[model samples]
Target: MFKADLPGLKEEVTVEIQEDDRVLQISGERNFEEENNDTWHRVERSSGRFTRRFRLLENAKMDEVKASMENGILTVTVPKVE
Candidate 1:
């Protein structure tokens, strides 16, 4: 799971899921705006590709996985089914 806060103008993000070796791989990108100016004092932030892997249990339902992004935050829900 990845977590970051973007101040002002909520960020937009996307998530993609894939399965491999009984594990689910989640990857996505978060888009943000950058300020351009002639003067710069310091820069401290992170942006780019990100990924997370989750081991699936025997009862986990991969087909029922759901994901959504809102207000600069992304949420993924994987349900366990019988």
Candidate 2:
């Protein structure tokens, strides 16, 4: 699962989860309030701190990885048991 929302910031979020292929990543950033009478506003969001890694399979079950974020939307739940 993947979610993104960073336009003016208000609970930024980022989540990723995969089972069979082993992949669990999480990201979060929220801090907005600096735009008004400055003549400068051009950013596609995505700043600082961002990591992602995944390459696994074979009964992957990293402690039932799970994540959650409100407002901005960020939910990652991986559960693959066989």
Per-model TM values vs. the true structure:
0.60, 0.32
Cα displacement (angstroms), candidate 1, residue 38, comes to 3.9
**Model 2: per-residue lDDT, tens digit, 33-80?**
457676777755545655556554566566776666566555555555
* lDDT (tens digit, per residue) of candidate 1 on 1-82: 3343433323334444455555766565545436788687565656666667777777777777776555655566778775
Q: How many backbone clashes does every candidate have?
A: 0, 0
Global CA lDDT of candidate 1, please?
0.58
User: What's the TM for model 1?
Assistant: 0.60
Shift in Å, residue 43, candidate 2:
26
Q: Which ten residues in a row have the lowest lDDT in candidate 2?
A: 1-10
